[model samples]
Target chain A: MSDSTKVRYLEGHKGPTVEIPTPEGVPLRFTVASGGDRAGAFLLDAFLIIMAVIVCGIVITALMVIDSATASSLAFVLIFGFRNFYFSGLEILWRGRTVGKRMIGLQVIDRSGKPLRVEAIFARNLTREIEVFLPLTILLAGDELIPNLPPWGRLISLLWVMGFIFFPLFNKQRLRVGDLVAGTMVVQAPRRTLLPDLVEEPAEEVASGEMARFAFTREQLDSYGIYELQVLEKILREPKTPAETLLAVSERIAKKIGYTGEMYPSLEFLSEFYRAQRAYLEGRMLMGDKRADKSVAPQAGKPRALQTKLSGKERSRAKPSASAEPLQWRTPEDPPQAASQAGDPAGPRVPPVPVVPPAPPTPPADEV
Target chain B: MSEIALKSTQFRQEREKRWRELERLVTQVEKRGIRSLTADELHDLPVLYRGVISSLSVARSISLDRNVLEYLEGLAVRSYFVVYSPRRRPGEVVIEYLTHSFPQAVRDLKVWVALSMAVTVVGFLAAYGMTLSNLDNYDLFVSPDYSAGRNPSSTREELRAVLMNEGEKVESQSLGVFATFLFTHNAQIGLLCYALGAVPLLLVGLLLIQNGLILGAFAALHEQKGLSVELWSWLLPHGVTELLAVMLCGGAGFAVGMAAIFPGRRTRLESMVVAGRRAGVIAIGCVGMFFIAALIEGFFRQLVNDLTIRYSVALITGLFWIYYFGWVGRKARPA
Candidate 1:
């Protein structure tokens, strides 16, 4: 399992993630927010600021009819307040989420995974004046402000501004100068719902009289482990899985397990295999023998002894309804078991008397 | 086979109600803030949060369905922020900053403040000496637009009159407008100084020196006209507060610049984080100082014509700031 767990990261994975260890010692992984999302949120906030300034201007103009001097003075103060406080105020109030961030489902979190502090909020937002507004103002009013500047100077200024603007692109975590300075990162805050259990779905198939068509002896079931079971479970749960893919996976598993059964439809073979594999692995798990993957063998003595004891108990409990259950153990007369044991190159373990037979395969149509 | 499945199913069923309840409360708080919650819900929030956290831990250990794990993780993250985020009221925060954080930050950055002060003084002395040696040099240091007719060409009486406020009527309404403009302008410069501090130290130094040069050239123009005493009275009344505010901003900038440049043993980003936080407190405080200075510059200097009163006001302000930043919040440390 350790090897398989490590392989998960090395293989195909989605976007960058930040792992923040909780107080309970469990590390929680959050997806780093995309640059496009951050930019969209910033634009939304900028639009809101512009609208606010325009509204304030309209109000000031109306007040001018009453007292022009006071109204104009109020206008200056209001604009100044808005310019400085708009980002910091909202971020502080909302605890690292501005109105734009909330709308976009993004949040500014401390990079080191601490709780976002008020100082950090202020520091990050204040940098926007330099990183964004200062350069923008300079660009718009550059010729008027510094008339003697040569063409190269203007280009240099433009480059300087672009460096700040595209800073996030240069970093793996997509951190802007403000985020870097404040030790914060923006992350996606996705809302997800719990899915129905995959195990329960197989149980429903049994209720509909679609009993399993293919089954494996205990030795055949031990070829794979929990990690592969989970991978198979993921494929089975995905609605868009293609029939050819299922057939290929089923054929591959049948070859690996050395099954000499009549071929069944791919989905039926896979589901039956998944259910039995899960039950077998879980039963071993209950006996304190967890097989992460097929690379490691099950522990030698204690777990095997516990498993035999558990199977004995299960056989006694399942005797009355054994025929309908489809998971019943067969005697040594089972032809497939004899054939599998003889063909197996690796010497077989002590053959217990009770063994399961190949039950009829359930069709995949009932699942959909 | 069914026993293990039944156990997990039963475990979820028993706790699912609390988890749903927590989700509802957390959603409500996120949308409308914690204030929107009823007392009972507020009390239940922390309790439910703990329940969800524990459930998440248990689910992780048991290797529950992947979707269930993801859902629990997301819920826990959201609830953690809601529970742990700082909830100090705005009024409390303002009071705390004004009384403690602002002064502490200023004291902490005193070395950078001294360095900024030295640069400004050096610029002032250089400009003053050059302008005094040759009156024509005043124009080089002070722009004509900024001088507002009190240049090297103006007569001694004209320059003195400019400083004395002999017969000018103080218009309260216009003064209010002037104060607002001055406040906005000075606050912007202070913020710029703070912002530039994060980039390079040289820019902040240049800005501070430019301001000092302007002041020095004007002083030399008055000194050349033998109206030095009158100029001092006129300038110092508000200059003490206003210049200090500007210098504080410069100092804050220098602190940030130093953190970025040197960073000591810490990583540059980590160093900047500490400096940026402290500098923010100083930057905010400077705005308040600028406002007070603007009020004095707009109203008091123009209204009060007595040099005695002006000099006394300047002296009082200098002392007040000395006490405010030095001794105001030293004794009651958070420890």
Candidate 2:
């Protein structure tokens, strides 16, 4: 059977990502960039190489007192070899961010979003002589290059240039000839996102009871990564976000987190869940306790009481409330840190099955 | 503010400052290299990294904004490489390639090397025999310009002078530069042959065979002129190394071409990709061979005129290369 990813690709997403799950259960997504970006970077790199070549040529002819004709020929070799070395060298040394790639906000990474290795760098740059540099060089300077070249030779060169240069446009990922050869990709480098300011929370210290409604076990919080958290935040911020969409997203998250309790308002559950999870995660970070990555979960029915008491890692399975306003969670009544602190990642964290009895409902709060 | 936006905005206001601070520090680390960081800055690196990672995870699961996600992703990746990946100096890389990667690649591509030899040998013998069999086909393969008056019609005396006069027609400094240009040009041709494999490989065959035909025709023409011995002696200083380099590239071309023609359960593109990787390595490793060949041809050939000494040099160099690919870097081979 065809891989589902290819099927989705054929169905047509302009650029699809290869998802590599990190230790945190967040898939570091690498999205393939457009061919135009590759060309842009190449042109920039080529310009730099050519300038260096000119300097070398002048040095050889003037300082070294070499004949101009010989210097030009020597310069040509330097120009060619240096182009290959520059890219392969810089990328491997810097783990795939070249000067041009850095400038264009593009990077070369393994399909799995792993850092690049020297082998791939060599593969791509070596093949580039034919796929990119050769064809481009011929197309641009054919007339003067081999003055008496045969018509067939010229035709082959032209066809060669066109074939490799345009190959990326035809592919779904806009991958160039070298990219195909090396099994590498060019992607837009991710940047820091500036989020809109959130409304200030109540001045009261985080209330243990309010946090109880959104209290998530470390595993529950670990289900989604920072990427997912921002995604949830974006949805929460949308003015016209539909109810069905919210329901669907929250339900999926709830299932993943193993929450099997009564369904609360999806928005309320998510926002309250977001606040609690954020607090829990940040607290762990502050304490230098490693967030339990998805791979290492509390084994079935296994909870360490001593370590849980010491680290105060959140071990509570989710307690989804039946409220409409998750805002009640932001009250600063000294956020129920003690309860979460009492819970450890290795404490009670069975989402599909609750380890503790249901708690009494909190008193209703005034609507914001 | 809407509850979620308020929550998100508050979250951002509380943590964005630290995230930006960490971003600046990380950017500084990246730009100036890790060594440039102060001791205090270095101590704070991981703490800040953890902060960003936590922030990224929280923002990702809660925030709906793609801008924040993108920012976190970029920072996370940069920091990930920074914390985990080893930094390599350019000199280290060059040394690594020369000592380990190149030899290992050459060994791995032994199949292509053998195939290239086969094609070249077949072409050499055929062209060598063709001139012996019939003089009429002489012009078909060997162009007169390249012949440098060493064709069948040339006298033995004229052919013998080619040994001394060949390649020296140019001045010394220009000769080295000219040779370097030829090496680059030939390297381009070798890679071109490999890339042409994507065109269903018809040209790949033509290229390999053309190289063979030229060698064979040249050998045959020299034999006809009764100057074959002198030609062999003259070519020995560089021909063995040059021929091996070209042959390896020819094998690379064939490997790429055959992968396209017969995909062996993979999609044609996938097969080509695999072959392209191998071919890429072969092409890269042998690039220096062209330079070595140019040096031998330009300086050594002119210096070492005696046939026996030239032959010994060829044999020693040939054995050295064989030993290199066979034994060197075997311990450090990548899994």
Candidate 3:
């Protein structure tokens, strides 16, 4: 499992990449944020903090007029401490987001694909003291403090400041000194849409019995998992993907999953394979078991909205409760739910109908 | 067997509903924060998340389609980040960090701290030896521009006067200004030491040596002129904190650099990250040390000319720090 992770990086891909695995062992997909976006977030955060500093400065100045001696030092500590404190505080509380990160649609996450942790946040922001804030402080503030300072001090401070500011540009991930240390990455929040399935309808394009061109045994269907299924799906939907590549992928997958049938066109095989896999997965789901988990008896108690509404609408729950579908009986034609009910001598556990017969030869797609 | 498979359209018909729902909820959470979701939507999120995960699981089990799998994977992750991550406040975070994270990190880098001390000590010893071996070696380490007033040529009485801030008019204002200057100078070196750790090949060791050399050369001059008593009093008032701060910063740098040079079992990046966290914390925390050191050097050092008083103050501060850092929050019950 870990071996594939090491070689996950491919050529031409920029930005920081993280691989998260589901229980099924396939990696989750996410797009890491670009540097410009992060910079924008940083600018927003910097702006907010600067406003705070200004407010603090005003308060300090007022205190100075009232009681000048300690106020100045108090002001310095406030400014110094707040700059370091702000991001770490916000990111940790906000779950790897500051006001700027939230506003800019950026989030920090563990590079290992775990939820963001506090140590990472602390490590990263602490580095910001030297990397982003302190250098600027030294270069600008130090210049004013000691007027007769030697030339070397000023030059060194300036160089140090520039190096930190530009460090992100040199790396694809745009990690600062802090991020590099924490093994955390600032990424855009995940927002990928499921593209419309392009597999042709039986009545629309596929010829009579063409869907059945590549038939497989139940054992063969059970042999492969969702990760493999997605690969096939990607090949079929991606028209731009080459024919040879599709053939190569499907052929290799067929061999690996123990599909013992006469070869059909790659698209037909994929369509058939997709359909069978879908049925099996849906059946399993009805039993209330996850992909890899042991099957449990389906609950007799239907949850709110699922029984009455279209599973899709209930799935999204997009409409407010006021307008949502209130009650609707299960349709006999509902392939998956109907199948779950078919062989339920006891619990409405899914896929049992298909599994009971083991090799109920040539069960129709609708009746499986 | 052939009849068992559904048409491509029917295959999607069975599952697209759940996939689409998850996609929308994920989108909503992404656009607005997760808390923006309605109660039902909130309840539906994990349910749908589990469903989608199951779908991916089944999809893989049957060797299902990629687009569907990709969509579910994306949706699962989106919801995971939102629903799973616990909200926290900045105050809580700061408290946790100060009470545990910062100190734990500091303690972890004790070896690096020692290494940094070694560099400073070696530098001090080498410079002291060179200057004491021959008066000419004084020119090798100490520059006239930086020496303020004391030098190898200065007589014993002059060195003693200068070491105790007795040479000039000893006005408080100039001394304060000079102390502030020294504080900034030390801090700049500290920052440099830590930053240069990014590339272990250069700067980390050199800067510490440079620091130690200057200290050694100055101390050697005073010692040779029979002004060690004056030198000890002058340094003790604030130098204890000031030097510790400098050495701590150097240690932080060495910690970061050592990660790069010797990553141990972890990858280079991983090791650097582990080291960078503790070292960077030490470096940032050391800033306060500098500020405190400056406060004492600027105000208190010049006012009190009594050597015993200065030494006692230094002793109390040193002991206080040892207690505070070593045991202050170790067994605390606060969150």
Candidate 4:
């Protein structure tokens, strides 16, 4: 690998950076995307909640009007079950991406940056039953029963709740136990470039003088045609590149074009050009990860991996990766052989009972 | 771009950021339920997202091309007045606070009225008993020094003639002047009863009760003397505005005391502050009532020497004023 490419790759390994590119001279600054767009999600959730409440209200009213104790109790349970089923089912099925998340450009993916599959989604969402729902139910019932406890059971439950509730904070990735067990991560949807590449029709005559002076190489320009070239450009144009190297690259490009002028194309421009060219040769397209290997042959010692290697700490920290292999959540046909193996009888053996209560519509007053 | 367009664009950008942040929050909530967030995390969400939106708005505003400033100003104003304006719908906190208690503020007000009415009934019966027994006449229910007369019916008539002749210029300089001479003198006693509420509520009620008792005695005496029509003429002219004022003042005072006594979540002092704000508004309303009473006394009462005209005018204006200020005023446009 060229020393320049080595320098380029090293920059990317450092830390998170904005990859979105805008026109030159336009100030590219951090802009908060609208949380309001997610207002719809809140609204959608709220609508569902309101509907549920209204339905429950009507049912309660009807029951009261008729004075049916048994019917009222049944109705209450049914409503509770319905809410849990939909809320948990949607979250798991969609891999943490709710209707709201989808509306607002977000998704849930696994650690490897892949959409969460069914098993992971189920595992993560099902925990809602034990961690949130059951605890609340038990607490309500417990309070009703003991009237007053020795404070031990209450304390234990309180600690268990307090401990689990704040679980997301301790981890950098913000994973709770469900997230950890399910191997999931919530991520912002990768934004697509607004402008597509301009097809370079045979130019009539390169605009005279300064314009033609820094004309991009055919291969270099072609990088812009592919979406992934922007990523490569982002990686290449780093502050760490020596000024001398940039000047040298600029000189080479200028010399090839046979131009001379009072001003020279900036080293940043040249570095970006080379980066784009290299990316084009590698055949990586925008947002396409699998095709990355075929496009660019990995030069020995370059470690041209799709992404930076996991940090040493991360690798060591990962609890012996519960293998990527799918665990059985019963398909209609695949009944468990015995409940032996993982000893997780909490699996397919327990016929799926409704877990979460139907989510009440999000209140408009809530900041959430 | 025109200034409005520029502002609109800026608003749009800020809105977009909020949407993005909300999207992020929802994802977080989905991955982890709301209970899972630490208090700090929960707190941070609003603060961070608010910061992000503000920063974006500032950036967009600064970046705006000056050419569009005027247009942007217009858009901002329009949006301020029209779009993005807060709905007047009752908020959850307010609704819950108002409804949660079984005996609401309005209900309590009714209880006060009932108590005042009871006081009036008992006062008249006591005065009647004194007259029937021919006791050393305690007719007007005031100390002999304050009493203008034991003949309540003719006393009322004489008071009316005095009001007509002297008009607004004739208020007694003494404190008792308001309770005694004014009580049977003008039918506007009702308006005074309601209006005095603008003061600390205790004063308003004391004035109302004092007036009600004296009037009860006077009316009972008038029945004994067989000069009820003469008393009615004297009482009706400005009494409507007076009575309405008293009730409104009572309502205002009740509001203040209630706020002080049961300040949910607020310190008693804080509740007093809120109640004070509401009282200030009601006081402003009382000023108008006072003016109306003064008008009836100065001009209308002078012309309507006939008892019938005075009574009818008082009755109509009294009812209308009471309905308007008491019920309608609650729904008045918030300043």
Q: Best lDDT goes to which candidate? A: 1
Put down candidate 4 lDDT per residue, A335-360, tens digits, no spaces. 33332312221112212122223323
Lowest lDDT 10-mer window, candidate 3 chain A? A290-299
TM-score (chain B only), all candidates: 0.91, 0.87, 0.73, 0.49
Candidate 4's docking class is incorrect
Instruction: Judging by TM-score, tell me the better candidate of 2 and 3.
Output: 2
Over the stretch B195-300, how does candidate 1's per-residue lDDT look in tens digits? Answer: 8888888999999999889888888888988888899999998899999989999999999999998999999889988998888888889999999999999888
Let me know the TM-score candidate 1 reaches against the reference structure.
0.76
- Report per-candidate TM-score of chain A alone: 0.57, 0.48, 0.46, 0.39
TM-score of each: 0.76, 0.68, 0.56, 0.28
DockQ (0 to 1) for model 4 = 0.01
Residue-level lDDT of model 3, residues B137-221, one tens digit each, is: 8777876767866677778877767556675666665555555565666665666566666655357788788878988887787
| Candidate 2 structure quality by residue, lDDT tens digits, B265-299 | 99887787677777777777677787788788877
Each model's lDDT:
0.75, 0.64, 0.64, 0.43
Candidate 1: regions farther than 4 A off: A1-14, A193-368, B1-11, B28-47, B61-66, B164-170
Candidate maximizing DockQ: 1
Clashing pairs in 1: A1-A292, A212-A360, A213-A359, A213-A360, A213-A361, A329-A355, A330-A355
Q: Candidate 1: which docking quality band?
A: acceptable
Candidate 3's error at B30, in angstroms?
Answer: 13
- The C-alpha local distance difference test score for the whole of candidate 2 amounts to 0.64
Candidate 3 per-residue C-alpha lDDT over A13-89 given as tens digits, one digit per residue, 9 for 90 to 100: 23545567643344665567887788789899989988998998889889878866557656655665576578888
